[model samples]
Target: MKQQSGFTLIKVMLMSTMASVVVIGALKETVIQERLTGNFQKDMNARLLAEKGIFTAANNLQKIVSDNSSFSVDDLVNQHGLHVGNGEIGDDTVYKARLSKSAEGLLEITSLGQRYYGDANQQLVARFELKPADIKSPFQHAVTGCKGVNLSGSGVVDSYDSSKGPYSETNRDSSGHVNTVIGDSSVTITGNSPIKGDVKASGVIYLKGSSPIIGDVHSNTGVEISGGGGTSYRVEGNVYSGGFFTHRGGEVKGYVRAVGNVEMKWGSKIINANNDPYDIMYGGTGNFPASYHAQESVQLDDGTTRQNVSYSDAYFRKTPEIEPVKVYDPSSPDYDPAKPNKECDPFELPLNMPDVMEQNPERDQDFAVGATQTYMFTPKIGRLMTSQVGIKKAVALDSKKAEIYLFDNLSQSHGISDTTEERVFGMKNFKVYSDGKMTITGGDVIFLVDGDFVLDGNAKLTIKSGSSLTVFTTGKVILGASGQVITEKEGMTSSGIPSLNFFSSYSGRDGFQVKGASDMYATIYAPLTQVKLSGSGQLYGTVRGSIIDSSGGSGVHFDSALKDVNFGSGGGSDEKSQLIFKGWFFEPAKPLPDLETDEGETSNSDSGSTDD
Candidate 1:
């Protein structure tokens, strides 16, 4: 009995030892599970923080697209990142973001989020992208006329990419592509000059003399080249015309295409840039060599057969596929403002000019002393005021102040012809600061003329550096033969300076100007006015009006720099500027090493300390 009792005791001791081991193992497993849960929670919190950073960046980007805001990611958030509250499962949670612009005008953004629970930490990252809405403008072209364009005499048209630097008559631009001349109607090139740009016209294109075109010339109507020496009249690029293309004597280095007849005179030739046979297209029937000169088989407008007809039979065939060039007329109900026009609509002003009434100026300021001297012409009733008078002080006019002249009714009795006495108003010598200096305050200084403005006598409008002048007239702007205007700013002799904007109302005397011997750089926008540049006048920048006429000695240079000028919000539907958003993305999340305790052990705490 004693032996049996001893065996039972041993069994009991062994069983108790096994039970203790199992309990110890269970406790260890619980601790490991808790640590794993803490780590998973921290990682998830970091990812959420990263997502929040992306959201914030998106909002800021939208703001920039809506308005002209700074494109800095740091500006959007505090140091390109924001600290939310405490992490869900960790401490010291924060997310940061950054912005960068690409050469293709793309906006890129990146964000990172991090969380810390004691010594353990986790991180996540993301990225996004954006683009500009509109980039169209009439200014992109060197010269664009709504009506027709006529290049006569020794007139020359060339191009300079201002993106390179200032343009000079001596140094041409580096943009391999030449300046472009687009006329909605006809484009007439005459004289022994040359055009260093592409020419496009919806109407007919008439080329005369030994004029050389460096770029392509395209017309919807016909292209007539009449001159001697095929080499003298050379086209470096292709030539396309919808109607009959009649070449008297010209050398085309590129393809020649015409919807109608292709009449090549004796010296005319066509070749590719490599001096090899090139392509040729003719929609209408015409005389042709038995064997074509094209590198490839000459294709007809029908897209079916090659030009394999005999010269004798190649007379009057028509191709129905070719369409005529559509001309742009503002009067057309389907007119598109985004499209170019041949002439400025008389009823519609240039989109550049702000529609502000001069009679009631938006910004009015009284002239300060030494800035201006007002002269009043208050004629007695029934009496004529006729006199050649003007102010030729050596005083330099202040651009901060305007010289406003008030006059009574400006009109002459219809029945009273001979009586210089019956003329109610007439100033023969109405001049302001003639032969004197004018100071531009870096801001716009307006000259408001209530009656007819005649820059007579030796009246010379001289401008100073960092200044701009604007002449707002309710009447006519007449410049006498002796009158002159010039600028001190180099490369800006006319009113083309950002400070000068000559605005004339449609109601005024048809915007008539007889300017001569003047070196002025200005953007004259008088759609109803007839602007004539005579007597060796050299004008730079853009000019738009009812009729633009220049003499042989006069010249007009279009400064490519004018494209950068903000001529007020553009007119028409397609003129307004805008922006747009592109898309978003998620980058692979980069994990950070887990923070550990001083003893190199992971901290798995139920409650973690928060980073203030």
Candidate 2:
């Protein structure tokens, strides 16, 4: 009986031991499953964080490319990498990003994401391609007024394609558009002059007298047309006004659209291109009244009367921003006033006076006072500096290439053939009394004038064929009565107009003036000054300024070839080029070293991945 009881006790102990082993195995399996699920969740979160890092890095790169034209994607590879944000997200998740250039010459952005607590990590790479952005030419119009424009007298505003030939009636087109960008400014066209192009203004546009606008007229504020003296004032193209449209004694040969009221006075009519009466469309809810004289009615082509109409499609566009002028920076390492490819910005001159004086100290001399002095120049004497040059007698320049810097004003009086008169005037108090026939020949020449430039009384500045002249001034420029700037020679098939260029940095009113019967064949760029064309002076190339005032019988002719000219690298906005996203990919998750410390805590530092 004792042996049997002992056997029962042994069997019970063995069963109890087996039950304990099964329960321990089941608990161990449950713990392993939970740990697997937790690790899977951590891996997904790290991957999502890596994607966020890639997108953020790409966004930053795009902005940098858009804001700076000189910025290149290669700069990123040189700098190794750029950090994205603070690199830390909530719940102990962190990310790191770097931009580099791939072997295919494309931009590649790499990102690493990690969760320190679980020791999970992810990596991704994105690629991008570079493309040129859409850029517009700065000189898209005949005359661009940064402030305002005034077209008075009988001066005609017209256009001609110099790429085709010189100005002729058959070679002309209606592309001579004039505009004023200032919202408070206006474009005033008065007298009997005819504008053979479109007129656009941000504010009001005033058209007075018997002048005719051959193309469309668009004004953001209002349009006023008034005529008298039995003259037929006309606008041959469509008229669009954001405000009221008033016609006193003129004719509109096309449709008229206004956001405000439309008024037509006696003898004023609206017609189509075929001279048939057309309806006026207005969007204003106010009353629009029309008045006519006794023998005149609103007659249509079918001999029927027509009435004005209303429209819901009448809309006004926001004014476009004007293109700013670009100037040179002296502090730049690539600063070269003679080179046209240098980068520049606004309010800075291309040439620095101090640098010029320092480089050509031996070339400094006073103005010579004698009989016609002839100066020959080679590469050794390519640069010269003078103070206040007054040309009385004839002065001849023969050069291969040269640059002349004038510290003060340059004045030229009437020419005199008598040497005795020159000597006598020289003996007297520095008063010039000789002919000012300054002739330039041989090669290209540039002049930098610090003060005013006055050419008057038969002062002739002749630029011979095969040679060009460029003038840069900081003061007023005046071509007075009987003054002539002859660029075109007899029997030349092509015009010499492109060879002469005038650039003024003056910021005052009437900074550039052309008086009397002088004819100018040059392009003028004076963004901060006022360009005035008085008397019968005719300008043949494009002109850009703060204000353009033409109050003479002669006109302005824009050369279409000037549109293809490139001034330099920097101007207006910096969005000249950009990059485009191509594709992206995920890299294999690199094994992260266990960061668990002895205190049963995870380390914050991610030392597994290195920046490249």
Candidate 3:
């Protein structure tokens, strides 16, 4: 029996010790792996902190850029460093960021996030770039409508650079090929019309009669061309249609591309503007350029580019041809409501309105009126100051002095001396609200109407040279049949027009109506209302609204200078400015687990070998 126990006690003890070593090593490795995972998670949190820092820096940079017109992106790279605190976490977590100019005028922002006394083990990094948003004009096109645009009768839609000499439609630019008319629904060009610029339609385009277009045509739906008998429909630019294209008569000087079939009628001509027939494409789809909707390149009088013309042709051409534009949806990340497109986005109201002093003691004097000699508010009496009130006896507003009128809500309640200078009365900047009909003949004035603006009895709001009239209305803007919002200044450019801004944010059925034989020279912005142009004369300025309606002969002449005009005093201290977002990326730090503290502490210690 003693011989049977061949295995000694020492051997048994050694085997037990080896097994204990293996188990201890396995537990240690498991703790190390778990510690590594915890460290990795901590690194991710640090990276998020870095990303937050980048966001803070970007917003601050935008504010700085918006405030300082003279500062360039390069200046930020050289002079700016931002330190941001993480409020979500403890105070130990902080981020430092630096901004610099990257390639292609982009702003590069680099942020370093650290925690626990900024230790190297608890740090992360992130980087992103910013691009300035482009500044666009709502008046870049001759006509931009959300419903449909119909050019009937002998109506002519043309383009002329107001930056040139006197404004004339005949002032053509050979290289300036901007879109003349844009309709979200359909476009009908009939009668003997001529469009000197391109045309775009989200639905369909009907080209009948003898209308000739000097530029291209694009349609997301289809294009139907019919010259009829003895009529010639000619198009000088390339034509693109997303759907079927049918040409019955007339000639296309440029190439034609369509996503559907291209049908040609008898005796139809396909002439080439560049001697290339291959430019004609059919049964294929293509994208529209980004600037296809609002790009204006004009030849100025001195042959110098406007300061707002900072964008290159390629910048706008970068849009995909397959899908150049999309129906604006607020929920879409691609859509930016702040970007102003006459065909798409609605206009945003400015914060500050024009300042017109109602009571300036230095210039307040009572003028003689009909032997009654009642007190008439006058900031500075002009040359044609008179007491007669009718349109025939309307005072000419073209005087050298700044004429002022007070339409105070408290004009009767409080005496002039007893009235506190509230906005309802008058401040140094804003004039009091007009409760009743206000009349003006001629003078530089700021008219503020809190209620309906009515030009009764064929009244003429004549604006002449050296005269600047700014009209702010909260209600309907009604112009009578004979009422004329005319600007009569020789050699006057787009600046001759009055600055008319409708600050109505309400969705009510408020509208702007210009009727009769009168002509209007004003930049009309009524994004929440409809704009209707009737009567005989033309409207020579930009018109933006929820819907635009014009009589067949009510010609609309878009002023090119509106691209840079400051409708509100809020911006445009420097003409060319836009806030863009460019390269955005988040980089996370790699996990480097520390063996010291990340592991779980264990108090139980047991030797595998029992004591002898």
Candidate 4:
């Protein structure tokens, strides 16, 4: 507008430069904001995919309630949008769907999905709450992934016969045999001695006898067992029983697991090896052996239909994660160096040993020839009951050789008593290797031991229930039973080693000892009172005591959360994966009918725990 004056070259250049700078800055800001928005959109979509999949599954489950049809993970993936093949983020991968119990009387169907990059991975999870809303009027939802398999009412057999081929609903021992048409099927039991064959029913199964069981029993829908009356019952499969497996007075063989709760009725005992001599069911997977009682009592979910049921204020979940490591012997070819290339053999003496090493007749070829000093006890064929480890005041160990050492270390026993101390064996010596399998059988034995002994390999040892074994600081002598009739020699001792010390009434006056066990991974299966964990190992049983201790064994550790434990101090001690003790902190044991305790505890005489 000023008309006529031509702009200067310098001004023109400056204006252009400023304009370019401003424009570039604005462009950069816009680009950054756009990128952020796009990322947010992508994240939102993925989240919706996960959540929406769950919602879709919930809606699809309409058919399951209507039909009660058994469903699997594949069915859920295909029918529901959970495993949507058209997922934008790589090929969609879905994990298996498993059914578990919910707080309410419902089933929880869930799935785990994941996507993997070079080193980074993302996991997506979805869950559906399934409740049998209408047991009768089963209807399916519009959701594709949802389906149903109808299972309701009592399971019964119209007629059963093991002898005449078809156990027709004719004349049979009607004592506990229920001959009725449950739901839409007829049920019958043959031979009368408590239905002892393969059974597939829609409803309840009412069989009689004193724990009447011969072979493995399986049920597809559900099973409700009253008293065993002493009959033995073995169930290899899961008891999806709408009711709990209650045994007022019955014993179960094999494993009696359920989709619900595992509990016992009135006066019952769930012992690893005791009482029932001939009652046991075998033939299954894993190292679990035969003749071990598997049933004391188990309840279904809370809402499960049952005649009568009892509940514990606390949940006793005893999980025994056993690392069955063998005792390594370097003398043999199967030697693995603790530290790579550290060639040291314990079983075989060094060639540099003085002439005195070879001439000892008692320790001749048999001891020196094979994998000896630095040997590991590899697992052979054996089965160990992980549920409950029996403890006692007195313990017994079988000698690997004619003469073995004994210590004051804890072992798998019943428990210890107060009035009997000097009459028992105290842990003192060191070189006692029962190969990790120490059986305490003598009556009311006592011990005072030192140091923590680790049991190598899958050592199988049984201990008396009511005996006691203690550990010592300078560890006392490895004393045996009365007049040392038990004949437990002293364990091998190292120059310097730490130990555990206890002189309480349970362990007694003479105290307990830590027997000499070099390549030992000893598992003390008992109602643990006080423990001093050393070395890197695990405790596989229950500890019903005032306090749980993890004082020593820097690298040595163990976990004793197998039995539902209580922590008075609400504390936790974990060193890597070696030791984890879920103790019954000041909590008393559940009052079981078959297993009772002394009144002195409640009355405050021999009361309180180590923590106090």
Candidate 5:
């Protein structure tokens, strides 16, 4: 038995070694497979969570905007999901925000999001960047929040606290071109290399060399280029023309939406311009194309700053309309706290909500719409269409989830569940609707529309500081016609009429939609801008960046106008509150030809005329 069992020691050792190698290989393969599967699942979950967070943030922002007609990151955070929580769509997983601006006025946002794994115990993280679609945004050069030198040129970025007075240049970089960026603190761009981002704030943005931009440029303000550059070059953002913006002798080859008082600079070889100085957009074109927007009365200050004087107004046009009398009770104190806010503008369409909130017998059973059609409420009014035309019904949703459109705040329990349903939302909460006869019936809807809005005879409209809006005809605001708009907000310095700095954003869909009775009366009690009228639509209100191009049609009818308003120093006169003409203050005619410079100009030789 001993002899049979006894294998040599060397043979036994060799067999053991072979077995160990096989076990290690098999174990490694299994671990690798598990890891791969885990990674894939983690990525999928992260993407879903990120999308959810974005939707949630957008919804909350809408709510803020609808109320004041404006919103910001702070407002969003206050309204939406928490930055940290258990849900997959927590703030850490998703966030809508604004990053710090460079000296050029570009905003950049950066963040990391965590994803949920199949098991409650597993999660992963992903880094991301959100770039805004405007010129001069810091995101292009990786200049975020308050870090780095975001100015145009390259060198040590000079730091100058505006609060501390005049800025001084300390460190000098004599190496090359001195197109340095003025930053928040100590930063620099070696003019040798094209700074990573767009040239911010100052309308004058330029590149010393022929290098094109790597990221989009944002001129939410405007842009000015020296050295003869024009429309043949690449610009990722909108190009605002304040003055004669010639590049370094090149052409612009991208999108440029100019909205200012007048053409800043004259045309050059870079862009084909007609002799008419104001005809900047149609520089070389002989005729003014209907599609071209000739900003006649616009003022392009410095390159980044501008204003469309002709149109400026703000308003909420809160649904459950109002013809503001005196803001008293809850939504502006009123005789009947339960009655709809009389101060709300009528023309401002109400956001669609659950009919349950209104006990009207004629309203739709519920505010639900299929993907095929816009939410139609047949409450005496005809079919209404909102920009948010394509929204799916909650009940009809395939996954039992209500397809919230233009809404925010999905996690904090604001959905229309089968049982615990309450108020639903519209686009980012910015717009809501119910296609029914808009007869004021219910506890007044008191959402705020930020800006200075003008209400015609739907006089219940109330505008406050910096906000501007124009009420058109058609709908009637809730408040009775007081003929006076309440012009005040909670945190305004002096009780002045609407201005620009008040809101982070604004709204004015259609500006005004006046019908037979819905006309803009006047706001003697409050300050106002110029009101223009001519055709079908009335001036309900206006946003900061808007142009009233009613020139092709009839002039907008304005029964009244504002008075003695100072827009700025050495600029243009503010006719009453109308910085620009009430109507379309633009040059619509085609530019005359430049035949004189070309060989096309010649005398007839057959009849003894000079043909030289």
Candidate 6:
């Protein structure tokens, strides 16, 4: 019995040892499975963090571009890396993003994510391309006046497509429209001047000339036509007026509609293109005489009679809806009182001069050249400042593209021969001058001036064939009689009108002036100034200003090609093109390196400390 009990104890001891071994093995397997699952979770978390970093960087870049902020790619490269963290991640996962330029010159962002308590990490890279944004241009009309427009002399208002050829009788079209935002007698056409296109005004339109208008006429107020010595000033298209229609001695070749009375005198007639009298719609009572030959006849002041004149009071019972013109008013919600020039039209001027000037770094040296010396400018020279500069010989640009900036106050005295002296009441007299010439031979060049830009005397600024010149100024612009802003290029048939452009921000009374015999083959845009063209010189491009006053046989030919041009937002608008997203990929895991913080301190990624 003792031997059997001893055997049972031995067996029980062996069984218990076996059970302990099995339990220990099972526990070890469970721990190993848990560790593998935990590691897998950490890897996924790191990958998600890396993806978040990419999105964050992309969003920030998009914002910068959309705001039109002045930023350089080098700035992002200098930042080394941008760190990101989340409150819900419990300080275990983080990401570091870096921006750089790829071999193809595209923008690339690389993100690396890590977990603090584990050895898990992930990397991702994305690419993008930069492009110019599309924005609406404000130069939609031949003449856009914030105040008014005055056309006199024998010069005509017409248009031609510069892309096809120069301004000729055959190439001309009736797209030369004139518009004004003012609400008085804002548009006047007198003398022998004729408008080949439409004329639209917010107020009264007065036409007194021998030449006829070949297009439609629209006014929110009244339409008055007075022929010069009964030479027959006619309108070949339809006429719509909100107020009275007065015709002294002229013919309307189309229908006439008015909200008020229609006054006809001295054999004024209304007929359609078929030589048949069209029915007139008038809201007020007017003289109507019956005749045997036709519907009606009216005897005028000159003892002449107009026959076949038909009138109907029921046609225009309600006033026609005319779209209101947007003008610069202080009470308007779009008006910004903080602007320096309050009279400048907000809708017309889209460039932000201050921001544009600040985008480029100022050159270390000043630009001062003697009258007899010639200066060769290249693209490497960048921007230079000068209180005043004189170029009696020539300031030539190299074959490579270049952009030169000249900043000056122009409140001091300068030694430029062709200058204009203006005397202020309480201030010292200042002379504004720009003499000599800047010739662009075989390159595209741009000159940005921060002060008054004047070209007087025999100054001749020439743009050669296959080259272009663009100028932007914030002060007065005067093109003297002998001065020439030419794009003809000796042998070519004038570099298309878009080759030369002048944009000004001057806001004074006579901010821009083009005198006699100046060969100006450039487009002038001075929306904040009073533009005075007093010469026989023909302008071959377009002109947009606050008020346009043309006299003395100065003719303006509009270039229809300007409608397709896209001028940038000048780095101050919230307009941008959509960012194109290139493909992204996961890179091999790598150890994180130390990065420089914005505060000029070194930060370690492995230390697990987040950037503030």
How far is 535's C-alpha from truth in model 5 (Å)? Answer: 27
Q: What residue runs in model 4 are displaced by over 4 Å at the alpha carbon? A: 1-7, 69-84, 87-128, 133-612
Alpha-carbon lDDT, every model: 0.49, 0.59, 0.50, 0.27, 0.26, 0.61
Which ten-residue region of model 1 has the weakest summed lDDT?
401-410
Measured by lDDT, the strongest candidate is: 6
lDDT of 6 at 249: 70
Error of 6 at 488 (Å): 3.1
* Per-residue alpha-carbon lDDT of candidate 6 for residues 213-237, written as tens digits (9 for 90 to 100): 8898888778988856535547888
Give candidate 3's error at residue 242 in angstroms.
Answer: 1.5
TM-score of each: 0.61, 0.59, 0.53, 0.18, 0.22, 0.61
Once all C-alphas are superposed, what RMSD does model 3 give against the true structure?
16.8
Ranked by lDDT from best down, the candidates are 6, 2, 3, 1, 4, 5
After TM-score superposition, the amount by which residue 138's alpha carbon in candidate 3 deviates from its true location, in angstroms, is 2.6
lDDT of 5 by residue, 1-612 (tens): 345655687798998999989989998998998988877755554444333333333333344344432233333323432322123343233221212222333221211223442231222222222221121111111121111122222211111111122112222111111111212112222222332234332223444433334233332223444343322443333344332233333343343333332222333122223222232341211222223333333334334433332111111011111111111133233355334222221111222223212322222223222223332211112233432334543221111223221122112122223433112211111222232111111111112222222323322333333233222111112221222233332111121222111111122333322222233322211101111222332222121111112211221111111112211111122121101111111111222222243242221111111111
Write candidate 2's Cα lDDT for 1-612 as tens digits: 454558888889999999989989998998999899888877877787677777676666676666544455676444425433323445467666666788888888777777754398888888987654443335567877766788888888878876565676337888888887653457898888788898888778898877898899988778998854335438889888878788887788787777776666667766655533324656554233333221223544456664432222122112222222222334568666464322211223434433332332223322222333333222123322222356343222222222223211111111223321100000001111123445544444455455555666665666776555566566677777677877753112132224577767677888888885977777777776888888887888777777889897868887666665433333334455567788988887663223232233222233233221
lDDT of 4 by residue, 296-370 (tens): 333334644332122231112222222211122335575544321111111111121123222222221111101
Model 5 Cα RMSD, 1 decimal: 29.9
What tens digits encode model 3's per-residue C-alpha lDDT throughout 210-277? 77877888888788888564444478888887777787777787866666655666656566557541
Candidate 3 error regions (>4 Å): 1-63, 66-134, 168-184, 229-233, 277-279, 284-326, 329-346, 349-385, 388-445, 490-510, 568-612
lDDT of 1 by residue, 161-192 (tens): 33343445346632122221223467666665
Please give the clash total of every predicted structure, in order: 20, 7, 18, 161, 152, 0
